[model samples]
Target chain A: MKTQNIPKATIKRLAVYIQVLTGLKRDGVEVISSEKLARACSVNPSQIRKDLAYFGEFGVRGVGYYVHELISSIKQSLGVDRVWGCALVGVGNLGRALLRHKEFALRGFSIRAAFDCDPYKIGEVVSGLEVVCTRQFKARVEELGLEIGIITTPPERAQRAANYLVDGGIKGIVNFAQARIDVPKNVPVEYVDFTHHFYSVAFNISSME
Target chain B: MKTQNIPKATIKRLAVYIQVLTGLKRDGVEVISSEKLARACSVNPSQIRKDLAYFGEFGVRGVGYYVHELISSIKQSLGVDRVWGCALVGVGNLGRALLRHKEFALRGFSIRAAFDCDPYKIGEVVSGLEVVCTRQFKARVEELGLEIGIITTPPERAQRAANYLVDGGIKGIVNFAQARIDVPKNVPVEYVDFTHHFYSVAFNISSME
Candidate 1:
């Protein structure tokens, strides 16, 4: 189910809504109103209703949303309900940290393997998972049947990692490198830069001033 | 100068605009119109003009904007000219990776020191900088005369990390912690989450589908 024509901001918030729904379910909450859900997420009430309206009605007119049902529905809407196996190409600090993070599995994405270039770190058990050397990453990913790869290599190594992931038949990538890599248009790449975090800090500081 | 209620999406785009402006300056462009800027960023031309209007008119009535001047102004507006000395806490995977990154330095932010409880990491240098032990973190931070703290600690350890930074006299915090923490009202805390990146990825995938 493709949803275009909506603002990217709205799409991002929908994911936040799903996270809120997850919290509600864990609390054994059965029903949640737009007001309650918005408050829990530190957002406006009408915004929650407005965003949900884009995907058709998941909320009852008076009863609000059925927590578990909404969680399942949002999962389907996000296309994250299906089991996803991902490969991580950099076993450096960021790569290893992401692997040890159990939250991804809790959120429906499982990392099947990790790769690195450092001979010392290579073959070392990192975050409870053995690190495979970068030399064999292509074959290891192929053997594991991973369709999505995460690129957490250093900026200098980011492009090379992307090329290897592409050659491995991975269709999607989440790049954490500061370096921007050129990839074919058909293959989607998402970049997550914590450097943006510093900008936001400055933004808030400027706003205060 | 305070931005007059720009959309968060537009503020984000402003960050991109600043980057592109730097590229244009390097290429020796004197002036550029909205259309060319849009083409470079893959955005709609009218949207760029509209986003710019929230602030005072930077472009002449017909001549577009002066590249070098615009870059200088945006940098000032973004607080990029000021050096923000930061303490890096929780030298886990994400922390270690960030220590090696130079983007923050390029943007005028420095990780003066890093902290972690892991005895193995505390006394060692990971990226040409020593990782300070968490036990002595507060004292070391004051010793360096730093006020900005980067919290790259885990979800469970996030609050405690903030507490330490607060006691350490940090006035600004760029937090990568998944969980929120309470700092004094005067202290500006900017939170960046990996899960939020996941939401953007999920959003992009859903829209593509």
Candidate 2:
């Protein structure tokens, strides 16, 4: 539970490690050495060992880690073992896609409600959840006990949506919009920036040439 | 330019720094000290200095960095100063959202082609690009000289889509699927995994509680 000093990079790596471990578990792999796991994740073996060391030891002295055990441990450490209720704002194309996205449900995060500012989008059902107006965002979020807020609105509307989430007392935010929104320090925000990945891909491809 | 030995983390940070710098430039800010830039990016000032050091010196001795100059230099170093042609596979909701996403075009990535296996999706125009069959992926990629292949297909179809992209001679891949895929060593792949962010957010929220 000593999360205060853990590096953000370490947390992100733990997520990746759990993902790879889940895949290994699916393949019926019982145990995996840090070296093998590192290779699978495209990370340095020493880095993998160091990252896991933040949460205490996991791997055996010689054999390495039990795939299932490591997956469960990491999932528990990341607080993803139980489902988290989430509310999503903006019912645009991107928002609709996120609503229909199966990965969120599969990964223990559930979109319990959807919200939109457009009068036309209001009352429209997407992915089994009826879209509500932003006016109801805070009340609905509080009523549903939604802990996470996902912003998928356009750049101009992102801040307003973020304010609504903040007013709703959302614990964490996942911003898919291209704009930066201000929120209190207590409410952690994670950006799902597609352009960053595009830039990285472009950099690597350009480097090769 | 010396591209070898630059850490992947540095590359990702560089992308973020550029985004922050772009925002500053938009606000009409001309020069910014490393400390200010780091604060905006939520990165260490020394880390920002070190990341920029990989490319070469940019800031003056005591005046900090010229925002426009630094932005251009970073973009040049990242190889994003010029536009890169890209292809998107799978015309699903996510794929359509990506097609309509304006950030990619703004960041110099152009989705020149789209592919899908579904007969209904094929021939349909979404975001100005007509959907094509997977059978035509390789040929269209080669003909259009697309360097980046974006896999937005279902997890089950991701690997096959990757195979087609590789066969078509893609330089890099942006995999939006939840599936881990295999591509040639030369073709660097970046994952846009939403679950990773969700897990991180969940962990932070749980820790605060």
Candidate 3:
């Protein structure tokens, strides 16, 4: 398939589609039309086709897309098939919570080392992941060839943490920190600010009420 | 204006519009055309017009949308003008981190109570918000007239926490717990499971890498 600059929205939807397909495969379903996929994703049918079309002719003319085949394609396409080591900085409450999660394990990425400056939490294990000293982030990351990191540090310290991760040679970052981090041009940053999402949620409820 | 059943996709974009408008307003932009708004939002011009037209005619045939007025209308449509007193269940690390955030304050929702069964944390003021006993949820909620809640409890206790919140008169809930809570048809529940969003994020990163 020819390379296309797929919109970030489209890429995000691709992940959602992969998830739905994975679910369908688990449920013993095989083929799925754009209409069914759109409904399940709470998106328009035209959107599903447009998004899937970006990757090439994954869908047949009449019979719809194959579930298991698409999952493999998406997994390979997303580069998730290879083990991507990650470091979780700031083993705070949210960081600790994420360390316990199985999603990272399934996707071939795990927080093998969680770094923190908090002396009290250092050397302790959070969800079986070691809480390493932040000072060792560069050396440990180099040793493991870690590719991604998560920043859950305080907003004031988030940028410093990001710089630390970037210097450690990580390319992708998922920042839960409020203050946006400055990553070099090559790094792809995804800000998962719960406050932003929560604002909309609270705003919606209040508006409805 | 007629009360039209705007698509959920359109409703979702309204939130994005508010964000874009807020940014534009901060920059002292006096007026913005649909194309420009779409550019800021990364959506197409036609989609912007269709979305804006749903609420009523905000754009003149030639003058485009009045930046401040459009923002005002969007804010009202998003129900952000009013304050919503929301309780937070489970004052774990993630929950505590959320309590200190100022974004929610600007959005007009305050975490009135943080509930946990841990006796060690009871009576401790987290970010100045009282950490209350789980046993006191219903009474405190009734007294406070809380209508919305955030369930940050672990997966095991998620349902019980959800039930307690709902029974106490919460009409809406933002569940961060991994478990899908069973709710009566009347109650509205939105899950913001980090695992789910993380899966999408990492999956997308892998796809494009």
Residue pairs of candidate 1 with colliding backbone atoms: none
Per-residue lDDT of A10-68 in model 3, one digit per residue for the tens? 66676667656766877898998878877776679898888767666687777888888
Candidate 1's error at B186, in angstroms?
4.4
Give the per-residue Cα lDDT of candidate 2 at A164. Answer: 94
Indicate the docking level reached by candidate 3: incorrect
What candidate 2 gets wrong by more than 4 Å, as runs, is A1-3, A27-36, A44-47, A57-64, B60-64
Q: What tier of docking accuracy does candidate 2 attain?
A: medium
lDDT of each: 0.75, 0.87, 0.73
Among all candidates shown, the one with the greatest lDDT: 2
Residue B133, candidate 3: C-alpha displacement in angstroms: 11
The weakest ten consecutive residues by lDDT in model 1 chain A span A2-11
TM-score for each candidate, following the candidate numbering: 0.80, 0.92, 0.67
lDDT of 2 by residue, A1-209 (tens): 53555677788778778778878888899999889999888899999988887777898999999999988777777778899999999999999999999878878889999999899989999999999998897778667879999999987798999999999889999998877788999999998787778888877777777
- List the pairs of residues colliding in candidate 3: A77-B207, A78-B206, A78-B207
- lDDT for B47 (candidate 2): 95
Whichever of 1 and 3 has more TM-score, that candidate is 1
In the range B120-148, model 3's lDDT, one tens digit per residue, is 98989888877888878889876786877
Q: CA lDDT of B206 in candidate 2?
A: 86
Residue-level lDDT tens digits of model 2 in B112-188: 99999999999999999999998897778767879999999987799999999899888999999877788889998
